[model samples]
Target: MPEATADRTVRIRLVDRTGRQVTDAEVTWDRLIRMRAEEHLPGHTARLAAVSGAGSATRP
Candidate 1:
């Protein structure tokens, strides 16, 4: 059987105070979306599980 994998591609733009690129640091859209979801969402465990695909969204 072949293993399953989820697509984790994310594109984002980041700049410093001078509007210059920061080396060794790349912002990901998925991470930012997950952070915002965690901050505004109510339930803690549910939200975390949803983001990490462990509880309900997990692949069987």
Candidate 2:
């Protein structure tokens, strides 16, 4: 879940890598959209790399 912040952006709480402290990170609407796509891109790319197609495939 996300909390609405005063900055007009949705804020999500994240724990530090060390797992000691918590922090608030603000994500704008545009960034949230990009983030959603970006989050899946790597997994999609990995799957594509692992799968060899019978036909030719070209990357942009």
Candidate 3:
């Protein structure tokens, strides 16, 4: 049997203090795009999100 690959889709949500969805900073946006495109691994995605202050990455 072939080995199965993990799903790389990560849902990222950014909201301001007013509870309104907002765009991420350049750094965060770059990371987000890369993550969403599956360019980064799950661990890397979570770390990037934390460092960029974008949000948390959870497994579902």
Candidate 4:
């Protein structure tokens, strides 16, 4: 049997105060681009969302 390669597709979502996804960034390296486009990876946007806390009682 032949070995199967894994699919690489990265999904990153950047949400503002209103939970809107703002995905925008630069890729200077080819590896990064490939990884992002074919590795199912998550960049800073995903990281930020993961660390962000829920909205507070007070409004900005």
Best by lDDT: 2
Q: Following a full C-alpha superposition, what root-mean-square deviation does model 4 have from the true structure?
A: 10.4
Where is model 3 more than 4 Å wrong at Cα?
A: 1-40, 56-60
What does the lDDT read for residue 57 in candidate 2?
64
Better of 1 and 4 by lDDT: 1
**TM-scores, each model vs. reference:** 0.28, 0.36, 0.26, 0.23
Worst 10 residues of 2 by lDDT: 1-10
Q: Candidate 4 has what TM-score?
A: 0.23
Residue lDDT tens for model 1, 1-60: 112211344455655669897544434555556655775455666767778888554377
Instruction: Sort the predicted structures by TM-score, highest score first.
Output: 2, 1, 3, 4
Candidate 2 wrong stretches, greater than 4 Å: 1-8, 14-23, 44-60
lDDT of 4: 0.51
Q: Scored by CA lDDT, what does every candidate get?
A: 0.55, 0.62, 0.57, 0.51
TM accuracy, model 1:
0.28
> For residues 1-60, could you state the per-residue lDDT of candidate 2 as single tens digits?
343532357776655458765756887766665665786577667678678652446643
Quote the lDDT for 59 in model 2: 41
lDDT of 2 at 27: 77
Worst 10 residues of 1 by lDDT: 1-10
Q: What is the C-alpha RMSD of each candidate to the true structure, in Å?
A: 13.5, 7.7, 13.5, 10.4
RMSD of 2: 7.7
Better of 1 and 4 by TM-score: 1
